[model samples]
Target: MTSPSDPIVLVGLPGAGKTTFLAALWYALNHSTDGGISLNALPEDQAYLNEISRTWRQGEPQPHTATAVFQEIRLCVRYDGADVPGELVLPDLSGECFQQDQWADRHWNQKYDSIARAASGVVLLVHPDAWKGSPRIADVARAEQLIEGSVAESQGEHVASGGAGRAGADESDQVEANVVDFDPLRVPAQVILVDLLQFLIGDPCFHTALRVSVVISAWDLLESRGRTPSVCLEKEMPLLHQFLTSNADRISCQVFGVSAQGGPYEDPRVRQNLLQMDNPIERIQVRDADGNTSDITAPILWQVRDRVVEERECRGIS
Candidate 1:
């Protein structure tokens, strides 16, 4: 049984819809004009909390400019037949953080190491696009290099390691050392992949033994492509299941088709422009980005809740 102090961490690549998912879940949980979840809250950095609250209140639908800024929310939830106040910490780091060489270094890894240890488990968000592209060889190499470098540095054997037992070396430092020692080749414990509209298909062996959940975002686009939820899932499930069975004997994964946008936007033209824009600066064009009036909140929240419950069951957590 997790204590009220335990928190859930959402880890994903940038653009994997982490923020969107969090926002949707936040709106559902609060369901009030006052905004924000309050119950037996876990302790958090007050200044950081205030910043995120302010940003959400501003209510602009702009994409995040930086992914390194950590955003979190706490809620009083009923779990295991008990009221346990839990926190959800969503790091602002982009999907790139997972493979970025710069942040894989000692300093960046140190920060993430601390956060990772504090959380009960992680919800890793991967992009489906990753499966289509030629496996990211460069990214793999970079990650390996970073891991080696971090390990060496933590052990005071790397070229960068100098000061011995400095005041800065403490829990966070120890955590960093532990993470540095981790073998990246192993599968993550809990992972979720969020695709714009694609479902997990092709192979089940790819996700064997791991608890996996597939989030299909941008449901509106699937309709635009002339597909229904049932049709999409039917086409994808066999492949996903087959792959999982082949890869791991103790795997539990599920497919959930969701639409972060809920439905087609009121102004289709704006959606077109936003989708077609290749440059972020170009996206600022007033003519570009249109707002939608569709209420996707209910459906999106349902999927999230279901997935949370499903994940808990899969992990044998009541």
Candidate 2:
């Protein structure tokens, strides 16, 4: 029951694989089988899809999206067993918009705000390798102690040495040199994700019971650990896990582990292996909450509507 204008927002930090996912998605939908989601017809302008999909299929590394760039895609999709087709508007915003403006400075652009209001679901991605450790009380306390100790040492030098305060000034300089500059990039991915979700919760225009698909992109890097996405979230990002669990009534959240490239595309061996596959589309990998491998559209379908079961029914799968 999704409208043409109600978008499924794609949110993620830089290098979290949004563009790559879009490319893979475009290819998957176009080549989807009888019981899978597919486009009713090609878009009027397939340039964007064509270029990106080409890059993806070639196993080339996707370029980083600039802050000012935006790509909005509208697709008329035919879901299995649905009588009428549905339109899916997916807005691909720069990750910098979320990192610098929203999470860091608390400034939401008017256009983004409007888009968020009309969003029926969200696909938020977090790359496993991009995680910066969350802020810890012990770390904060250690920083405070360092500052306090520096202040005490400076005062002692001034009072005892009485040497024109040069020693105190030098000590102050040392302390300043030791302190690291505050950069938004240093903020933990989970912390920013939690903040984004909290903003959505506080927005009166945004609906409660919003479906969110939290995808752990670059899941291939962690697949050897033998942990599911939910378990990975709980262990790596306990705060976010707890928040989502507590707000389950307001937010319907699912975790997915997706390997859009199947492996590091830049690696010769990996790229060769992917290229050797009979179908290039087989390079995309998606694992649902239960660790079952699924189609790339599975997460998107779940977000837009609970069509996973319907898809199974149409396929006549038990």
RMSD of each: 16.7, 4.7
lDDT of 1: 0.41
Provide TM-scores for the models: 0.45, 0.82
How far is 285's C-alpha from truth in model 2 (Å)?
A: 1.3
Off by over 4 Å in 1: 1-5, 32-60, 65-67, 72-76, 79-81, 101-108, 117-121, 126-210, 223-251, 263-318
Candidate 2 accuracy as lDDT: 0.80
TM-score of 1: 0.45
Highest lDDT: give the candidate number: 2
**Model 2, total clashes:** 0
All models: lDDT?
Answer: 0.41, 0.80
Taking all chains together, the TM-score of candidate 2 against the true structure is 0.82
Task: Indicate which candidate wins on TM-score.
Answer: 2
Please give the RMSD of candidate 1 to the true structure.
16.7
